[model samples]
Target: PLGQLPVLEIDGGKFPQSLAIARYLARQLKLGGKNDLESLKCDVIVDTMQEL
Candidate 1:
């Protein structure tokens, strides 16, 4: 299983990383950053969360 959990599936496509999966869902669901600044903020959170 590659030792991973909470895999994301969209349109039959699989994504393993939580941040990438979250970003994809956010964009598709109209909850993602609408500009560069917001995108940067989201990225920062993603990075910090990965360290936890």
Candidate 2:
């Protein structure tokens, strides 16, 4: 069974783009926003950071 190991968890996976990963995590955590306006603000901050 060593050759066919089960995927118990994903420890370290590389993200092609940091921004995309950040956005995904934000959404998963519900840290992005509860409504349209807050979501827009979260997106703007992400964009600003990416610009830098």
TM-scores, all candidates, are 0.72, 0.68
Q: Cα deviation of 34 in candidate 2 (Å)?
A: 0.5
After superposition, the stretches of candidate 2 with alpha carbons farther than 4 Å from their true spots are 1-14
Supply every candidate's count of residue pairs whose N, Cα or C atoms clash at under 3 angstroms. 0, 0
Those runs of model 1 whose alpha carbons end farther than 4 Å from true positions after fitting are 1-3
Give the alpha carbon lDDT tens digit for every residue of 1-52 in model 2: 1333222223574445556767778898999999999999999999999899
Cα deviation at 24, candidate 2, in Å, is 0.3
Query: What lDDT would each prediction earn against the true structure?
Result: 0.79, 0.73
Give the per-residue lDDT of model 1 (tens digit) for 4-24: 776886679666878778788
Per-residue lDDT, model 1, residue 9, is 67
Among residues 3 or more apart in sequence or in different chains, the pairs in candidate 1 whose N, CA or C atoms overlap within 3 Å are none
Cand. 2 TM to true fold: 0.68
lDDT of 1 at 36: 86
